[model samples]
Target: MILTVTLNAALDITYRVDALRPQTTHRVAGVAERPGGKGVNVARVLHALGEPVLATGLAGGATGARIRRLLAGGGVREAFVPIGGESRRTLVVAAGDDEPTGFWEPGPRVTADEWDAFLGRYRELLADAGVAVLSGSLPPGVPRDAYAVLVGLAADAGVATILDADGDPAYLGVRAGPDVVKPNARELSALHGIILGRSVTVGTVDGAVDAAAAIRALGARSVVASLGPDGLLAAAGERVYRAVPAEHVAGNPTGAGDAAVAGLARGARTGQPWPERLRDAVALSAAAVAAPVAGELSLEEYERQRAAVTVTELR
Candidate 1:
């Protein structure tokens, strides 16, 4: 079973507008609410794909309860530790003509006692987990090295861990050594102190292979870098591969990365080869981008796109 850990769980609210203009009023065309946080999003996608997943995280107050109910309704098994503080809410305003704008709350403050309680719950859950996914940001009062600690615990239990996060938590988690690390181009640049938008384009097979090798050398048993419409590039051990999407169907791009991580986790649990894993990741992410809601993908769309995913082994 796939075990997912979300440190700062949230209730995600998305609003779609024809266009966003500062200091102007606009009518919202649609809205959607979902239980969110990177790991939670990942678990939801896996559950939709018929994978057995256990989502563990910190939650509190009415919003937390709502999130739990929503996950249960979606057929995802969850084990969350309730705290005294209220969980956070995130707002995504998608402009019909442009990229979505995000407003995020830092989340509630967690106490030392609450942290300890969460650790205890994690230990119990990790005992039977096959693959562990540590994702999202740390709450205000939680330690920055939270994912690092969980990485150590999962490793001790002989479970491969996949980390999808950013900033210090991601840097610290890498030091703890996870089996796989999925980061988008911006996050990758931030981790390595490279400039954002300064990506090395791979128009040729050899260039893609070289870039994949370079990414793997930075640390990580495997690296999957999502390159927007260019598709995804993956490097595992000495083998490198690139999977291109069948078409570019634009919608809300908010949860594409989380969906990709879910696909990768599902593939890992099912013993799918690296090539298939890349294909699934690309297809799922593409499907997510085609959906109007954040962190949700159309399963039928994913299945249709899955068959058209073109993967080339560059190594």
Candidate 2:
């Protein structure tokens, strides 16, 4: 089974309005809530694809209890370490044709004892898992090197690990040498001013290529950069493959990246070749875009993209 870690899980709230206008009164047309955060999103997509995946994180308070209840009802196994503070909530407003606007509340502070308790729990979960996905942000009071430390622990346990994060945590975690690290194009652009162990700025795929390679140099076995709408550029072993979609498949894009991560995790677990891995990643990503709801993938679109996606090895 694949294990997913979300240190800062949230209650995701989405509101649909007829038209979202700035500084104007509006009535909500619909409301939806779900357990969220990068790893939770990935777990949901993996479950939908019939993968044996378990999700764990820090949760507490009424909101956290609600998140767990939703996950349980949805059939996603969860093993969260209870915390003292209330879990945060993410609010999204969808109006007209405009892209959804989101407001995320800062998660509650984690105490030293709580963090220590989690370390033991995480290691226990890693034993039964083949791949561990460490994604999303660090909660308040947690160290910036939290992901890095967890990656090291996973490594020590002989488990393959995938890290999907950004900023300083991303840099530190990459330094810990996970099996794979995934960063979106924009995340690569800044990279916390460190690429190839040197300070630099990058935003484009071309720039990320070098950064991706640098991350590999830092100890990660491979790196995948998610290029929005374009597809994926994956560097594995000594080869790089560019997986491009035939056309844009657009819908709710919130969980597309998470879906892509799930593909990579599945590929890693099965020891699939780089090309096939890229195919799965791009296909799942496109399927997510074609999905009607958040955290869901269109199986039909997934199958079609599997056949239509073009994966070319880049020299």
Candidate 3:
């Protein structure tokens, strides 16, 4: 089973309107809510793909209850550690022809006791997990090296790990030698700067690959960097491959990275080749862009795009 950890899980709410204007009140056209946070999003995508997944994380209060309820309703197995603080909610305002505007609430501060409880739960879940995905932001009061700790534990349990995070957590996690590290081009660039004190130009596949390789050298077993519409660049072992889509699909791009992480985690669990993993990840990411929300993917688009993905080796 694939195990996913969301340190800061959330109830993702999307509101659709005709148009968003400065300080103007309008009737909402539609509203949708789902269990979210990076790892939760990955678990949702994996479940949708018919994969056996168990999502575990920190959650509490009414919003956390709602998140777990929605997960159960969606048929995704969840095992969250209850806490004293309430979970957060993320709001997305989608206006016609305009980019979605997001308002993210700060995560609740976790107590030391609550964090220890989560660690205990995580250790137990790793026994049945073939792969563990540690993702998202570290909530207030949680250790900054949270992902690093998870990655190390997964390694000790003989389960491969895929880490998706940014900033200090990501820097520390990379040192834990996860099986895969999934970051977008911009995040990769920033991380590259953080780790090596060097600037990496974003939007160029070569630059992304170079930055990813630098990260891999720092203890990550492999690096799979997403290049938005351009696709994915994977640096694994002594090989590097580029996976590109035949065409771009337009829709909400909120969960594209998480979808890619789902594909990578699935592939790693199955021991697929790096090229094939990148192909599946790119296709899944494009399909996510064709969906209206963060957790859903268009199956038709997935099938079509999967076949059309081009995977080429890069020097």
Candidate whose lDDT is highest: 3
lDDT values, one for every candidate: 0.84, 0.89, 0.91
In the range 24-52, model 3's lDDT, one tens digit per residue, is 89799999999999999999989989999
Q: For model 1, how does the per-residue alpha-carbon lDDT over 141-254 read when each residue is reduced to its tens digit? A: 999889889989999998889999887888778778788888777666656543123544444545544544544554567878777887888888677788999888677777
The TM-score of candidate 1 is: 0.88
Residue lDDT tens for model 2, 1-315? 999999999999999998877898988989999999999999998898899999998998998899899999999999999999999999999877789899999998999999999998999998899999999999998889998999999999999999999888988898899999888877766563565455576756677678788778877888898898889988888888899888988788788899999999998888888898889999999999888878877778899989999998886
lDDT for residue 106 in candidate 3, whole number 0-100: 98
Q: With candidate 1 superimposed using the best TM-score fit, by how many Å does residue 300's alpha carbon deviate from the native?
A: 1.8
lDDT of 2: 0.89
RMSD of 2: 1.7
In candidate 1, stretches whose alpha carbon ends up further than 4 angstroms from where it belongs are 16-31, 94-101, 194-219
Q: Estimate each model's TM-score.
A: 0.88, 0.95, 0.96
